[model samples]
Target: MTGSLWRRALAEALGTGLLVTVVVGSGIAAAELSPGDTGLQLLENAFATALGLAVLILMLGPVSGAHFNPVVSAVDCWFGQRHGGGLAVRDLAAYVPAQVLGAIAGAVLANLMFGEQAVSWSTSDRSAGHLWIGETVATAGLILLIFSLARSGRSAAAPAAVGAYIGAAYWFTSSTSFANPAVTIGRAFSDTFAGIAPGSVPGFVVFQVIGAVVGAVLVLVLYPTAGDAADEVVVPHTESGVTS
Candidate 1:
């Protein structure tokens, strides 16, 4: 929270952009490499994403808490306000927009790398009640995992824990666990393996927000604090030693 807003925003943007690049790029590679085997392709994609996410978090968590997801930023801000050591509202404002723009750029980057047209809208329609439910569940679980780690003083385990959870959720959830809204929107710009149709983006985002609320409520129920927990300095900036 003490870092300059510009530096934190840059970290969020770069981290989110790289995250989406890994997702869409891996998906495209997997599809190409494992032509007829859908299961194999999924496995490959999931593995890449898990590994990539873990590394990104480790690299950028010190810079911006590596909150590549808007819901995570929002939740962190809410917790900061309630507990007296979290992201400022203005920071949240900057972070979300940066993440969204980063995601779009990442998608376009992936498409161009894969020899596809840049900025092509996806045609992969994912609209369905069941899919929405799956997204909700996936996102909710993600939020729960993150806040639970913070509450339990186990945030150091976040890189592995979060990566592992998303890998599992990819298979466990029917919608392939597009848990992060920024990533979901980014995928809309690609028409390849990991893309989500533009039309389906809204429903998915709404459900993810609902899921975030559910997760926050769960945190309140599960970890009622006796007093403010000391904020950990996970992300460090040059001027401000505060972490998100």
Candidate 2:
């Protein structure tokens, strides 16, 4: 709220771009480095993603709140508007587009880095019902964790906590926890180890949205005052200063 809208949007773009870059790039690296070893590849990919996400949050959380995901931005907008403080509708408008575009750019960058086609559509189909359930659970857990931190004055732990959760979710969730819509869309642009087929995107996104709604509702029910901390979710950020 303290910075120009453009600046915040720019931050979101850059943060999300970097996040996807880490994910896709690491996946590619894992495949190349650990060929035929699915477990090893996943381990490497999950580790890099976890560390990269935490670092990115710490680096950019003070700007744009480092949302890097449409669901997070939407939740912020909803709670912010309803509770008197959070991302405004205009901010959501800019942030979501920026995040999506950034995600695409990140995927392209990763492909180029790995000597893959710049725009190869993925063929990895993930249409099983279990996968959809995984997405829903992953996304819901993410939302619950984020909002809970804000409500509990534990926003400072988000950088590490979020990263750890995603890393763990990668192994626990059947869908590898593509819990973010932007990231899911971006991954579709590459046919690498991390990519998902274009046809599979809608289902994942829909479930993710459902998960977000469920999570938000749960937060409101469990912590009636959670919205009061909407401005602090992920990390407290402002043009003037930052906390946590």
Candidate 3:
């Protein structure tokens, strides 16, 4: 049990670190690779995010349940995918700090490695407005995909599905699909290429929470049962492969 838990935490930390590296690290890289060509930055981010999520899920699903996003961990509670009573608290505690630190670390490396300066918030214009809508829909779509995949006992496919959706949504949606709140919060701490000003973080988080709640409600409307999520496989001794 001890070893399993350490692995879980380690997986989360490593997963988050990789995510940050992709988000902030690649953003800085993009900025350096092509100055004033933010379009290329977005493109790079989309692909990197997809790759990051896919790798994280496969690498950590067996242990930490591969919840690289705090919002994912939160809504998983509502879907009954994650054990509700106390599991939420513990996962949140671990994921939030891990992600925050990872983002900062990524940002630090980006600055030192790329010589990118701290920049202000991207923009609050139409693009940002579009981004808001994109955020809402992207988050909704992501949760729905997870709910459906889990309901079908195909949770193994979830990482790729989510990664693909997020990557594609980056192109279709008006918002660049900042679907994960923890990532948003962490991004704010860094005024790097991917950074959203501290001012923008709160509004993004609010929308993210609302989107997650909506996702949870949709899960109830669709799956409605724990068994709907998985086959009757024998487990060692915990609900949802996690212990209290």
Best-matching candidate per TM-score: 2
Candidate 2 lDDT, tens digit per residue, 27-70? 99999999999999999999999999999999989876778889
Off by over 4 Å in 3: 1-3, 81-88, 116-130, 226-244
Error of 1 at 197 (Å): 0.3
Model 1 Cα shift for residue 147 (angstroms)? 0.6
Residue-wise lDDT of candidate 3 within 1-244, one digit each (tens)? 3554456556666776677667777777777787898899888878888888787776656556666667776665444444433234555566567756665555555555565554334333323565676788878877777766766676667778878987898788776777877777667655667777777777777777778777767867877764344221111113334533
Error of 2 at 43 (Å): 0.8
Highest-scoring model, lDDT: 2
Across residues 116-196, which tens digit of lDDT does each residue of candidate 1 receive?
Answer: 999989999999999999999999999888877877778788889889999999999989999889999999999988999
Q: Cα lDDT of model 3 overall?
A: 0.65
TM-score of each: 0.93, 0.97, 0.79
Native-structure RMSD, model 2 = 1.5
Q: Could you give the candidate ranking by TM-score, starting with the highest?
A: 2, 1, 3
> What global local distance difference test value does model 1 have?
0.85
